[model samples]
Target: MGKPTGFMEYERSVSHAEKPKERIKHFNEFHQPLSMEERKCQGARCMECGVPFCQSGIIIGGMASGCPINNLIPEWNDSIYRGNMKQALSRLMKTNNFPEFTGRVCPAPCEAACTCSLNGDAVAIKENELTIIEHAYEEGYFKPNPPKVRTGKKIAIIGSGPAGLSAADQLNKRGHSVTVYERSDRLGGLLMYGIPNMKLEKQIIKRRINIMKEEGITFVTKADIGGNYNAEEIMKSYDSVILACGASNPRDIKVPGREAKGIHFAVDYLKATTKDILDRNKTLTPDFKNFTITAKGKKVLVIGGGDTGNDCVGTAIRQGAISVVQLEMMPKLPDQRADNNPWPEWPKVAKTDYGQEEAISLYGEDPRVYQTTVREFIADEQGNVCKAKIVRLESKFNEESKRFMMEEIAGSEYEIEVDMVLIAAGFLGAQSYVADAFGVELDVRTNVKTDAGNYQTNVDNVFVAGDMHRGQSLVVWAIREGREAAKAVDTHIMGYSNL
Candidate 1:
C-alpha cells in the first residue's frame, strides 16, 4: 500500500464537470480534471485489499462486477501515490491498451467494486488513471516502439473499433504485419460517431491511432470488405482474419406508423450528425441542409432508457430541441442502494446521467417518463410523426407461469405531440451481411459461433471477437477479447504464442 493510513487520511474526491446549461451549448468535454494534489489524495484512498475485487473482472448476476480487462489497479494506485507516473502508466498499459478512452467513457466498475466502497465511498481509480496517462503524455514519456523484427505473417482485422485496434496493437507487437480495415471514412467506429464529442473528443482517439500507426500498424479507412471489396478475396490473401465489426444491427420498434419519415434509428442519427461535423470541418462548408435529422425547435421523444437513450437526450438538448421526453419501460429505481444490494457490489440505484442533468436544468424537471411505453405513433399528412400515444404499464411476476409480464394499466393512455422519435432500444447483434459473406455460423442470439475457450469460428483461418462474437458488451471486454483472439491467432500461425 502507498501509506498505511492513507485511506483514513484522505477522502474520495471525483473530478468536477461543467454545469449542464453551460456544457450543452457546445460539443466539447465538460468534465475537468482534478489538480495534481487532489489526484494524489484520491490515489491514496486505495486500501489495496488482499483480494482486490476491483481488478477481479468477474461476472455477478449476469453483469460485469469489476474491470473487464483486469487492470492492475492497486499497483498503479501505489505508483501514482509515490509520484512515479511512468511506472503507473506502464502498469495500466499492461492490461488496457487505451486508458484515455476508458478513463473518460467507462462507467468505472473498478470504483464500484473497490474495498473502500463497502462504506459507501470508493477510491477514484478512474481519475487517477486519467491523471497518470495525461501526465505521461505531457512529460513526453509515451513514444512509438515499432517491432524489432517482422514475422512475415499478415493479419487482417475488420472494424477498426476498440477491439480491432487492441488486436492490431498486440499482434503488431508480436512482429506480425497487422492491417485494420474500417467501413466508415474515419477509424474508431463507435468512438468516432456513436459517442458524442462532449463525452470523448475525436482528437484524443486520433492521437492514439497516430501512435499505433507509428508502431508499424496499417489503418485502411473507407474500406468495406463485404461491400466494395470481397470478403472471400481478402480472407484468401491474409493469413488470418479477425472479425470485430461490433453489434451494428440495431433493434427497431415494430409499431404502427413506424414507417413515418420522422422516425429514425439512434445509431443512424448519431452517425449522420458526426459525419456532418467531420465533413464540414474538412470542407469549410457552412451549409448543413444535407443533414436531414435536426432536433432544433422540435419535440423529441426518445424511446428506451439506457446509455444510448441518454445520449439522444443530451444530443437533442445540444441541438436546441424545444422539449424532450425519455420513456422507460421499467420503473424508477430507488435513490439509495437497496437492502439486498450489499457493500462491494455495484449499487442498484437511480442517478442522473449528463443528458438528464441538462434536461432537468432547462425544463425544471426530469425528462424521464418511467413505467411507460409507446402504443402507437400519430403522423401528419407528410408521413412524418407528429404525436405519440403512450400507456402506463404495471409489471408483475406470474407464479403460475413462472415468468414476468407487463400489463397496460386501464385508463392510463396518454398522448404527447412530438416532431421526431429516436429509437434507442440498443443493438441486437452484428450485421448479417458480413457473417453471411464469410459463411460463418451464428448462435441463436445472432452472434458469431465460437467456443468459450477458443474464439475461432467454423472456418480454420477465421476468428471472431468483441460484440460480433460475444454480443453487445463493454468496450473493455471487447479489448480483452481482441487481445485473447490475437493470442489464439499467433498460436495458430507460429505453433507457439507469446501474448
Candidate 2:
C-alpha cells in the first residue's frame, strides 16, 4: 500500500467527459484525461486490501466480478502513488496485452469488485490504467523489442482482433514466428470497425499494430484464410494454428417485416460508418456512397438496451437522425442495487450512457422505452420501413414451467413512425464458413468447441480462443482468452511454454 489511509485521504475521481450533445457532433473520443497529479491521487485511493478482490477475476452471481486479465491492481496502484510509473506500466502490461483499449472501452469490473466500493466509491482503476499506459507511451517506453532469437516453429493466427493480436504478441515474445491473417481491409477486427470511433479512436488500434509489426509480428489484411486462401495450405505451412475469429453472427429479431430494406444489423451499420470515415480521410475522391448507412433526416429505432444499442443511438444522433428511440424488452433496473445484489457483484441498476444522454439533450427525454418490444415493422409502398408496431410487456413467473415469461399487456400495442431500424440485440456466434472450413466442432451455441476449460480443439495442432470459443464477451475477456490460448499453443509446440 502506498499510503495506509490513502482511501480516506482522497476520493475517487474518474476521467471527465464532454457534454453528450457536444460530443455527438463529431465521431471522436470525448473524455478528457485528468492532470498527472490528479490521476496519481486517484491511484493513491487504492486501499490495497489484504485480499484484493479487485484483481480476483472471479465470477460472482454469473457475472465477472473483477479484472478478467487478473491485472496486478494493487501493485500498480501503489507504484503510481509513489511516482514509480516505470514499475506501474510494467505491472499493468504484465497481464493485459492492450490496456489502452480496455482503459477506454472496458466496463471496468475491477472497480465494481474494488474493496473501497463495498462502502465508498471505488478506485478510478480504468482512468488510472489509461494514464499509466499513455504516460509510458509519451516517455517512449513502448519502443519495439524484437525477440533475441527466433524459434524454428511457425504459427498462423486467423482473425486480427484482440484475441489474435494478443495471441500473436505472446507467441512472438516466446520466440515463435507469428503471422496474423485478417479478412477485413485493416486489422483490429471489432476494434477497427464494430466499435464506433467516438468510444475508441481507430488511431489507437493502428498505433499498436504498427509497434507489433516493428517487433516482427507479421500482419496480412484482406486475406480470408478459409475463403480466398485454402485453410489446408495454412495448416500445412505453420507448425500450429489458432483461431481467434470473433462472434460476429448477429442475432435477428423475427418480428413481421424483418426483411424490409431499411433495417440492418448493428455490426454492419457500425462497420460501414467506420469504413466511410477511413475512406473520406485518406482518399482524394471519397467513394463511400455505397458504404454510407445514414440516419440523416430519418426517424430511427434501435432494438436492444446494451452497449451496442447505445452506440447505435449515438451514431444515429451524429448522423443527423430526426429522432431516435431504443426498445428494451426487460423492465428498467432500479436506481440502486437490489437486496440480492451485494458488493463485488455487478450492480444491476439503471444508468444513462452517452447515447441516451445525447438523445435527452436533443429531445428532452430519455430515449429508452423499457418493457416493450417491436411487434412488427410497417413498411411503405417503396418497400422501406416507415413505422413500427410496438407492444408493452410485463414479466410473470410461470408456476408450471418454473420460468419467468414476457406477457404482452392487453390493448397496449401502439404504432410509431420510423424510417430505419438497427438490430443491436447481440451476436449469436462466429460465422459458419470459417468453422466449417477448419473442420472444427462447435458447441450447441455455435461457438468453437474446445475441451472443457481448455483452449485446444479436437483437431491436433489446432486451437481456438476469444469470442470464437467463449461466445460474445468483453474485450478484456477476449485478451485473456488469447493469452491463455497462446500459452496452450506454445506448450503444444515446444513441449514447454515460457509465455
Model 2 agreement with the true structure over 1-499: per-residue lDDT tens digits: 7888889999888778898767776788898889888888988899989899999999998999999999999999999889999999889989998999999999999999999988889999988998898999999987788899998899999999999999999999999999999999989999999999998989999999999999999999999978998999999999999999999899999988988889999999999988988877732122223347988889999999999999999988888889999999999999988999998898888999999999999999899999999999988999999989999999999899999998899999999999999999999997899998888999999999987889988887889989999999999999999999999999999999877
**Each prediction's TM-score against the native?**
0.97, 0.97
Q: Give the Å shift of residue 138 in candidate 2.
A: 1.1
Model 1, residue 349: displacement in angstroms?
A: 1.4
After superposition of all CA atoms, the RMSD between model 2 and the true structure is 2.1
lDDT of 1 by residue, 78-172 (tens): 98888888899999999999999899889898888998888758889888888988898888989898999999999999988888999999999
Q: For residue 416, give model 2's deviation from the true position in Å.
A: 0.6
Clashes of each: 0, 0
User: Model 2 Cα displacement at 196 (Å)?
Assistant: 0.6
Clashing pairs for model 1 are: none
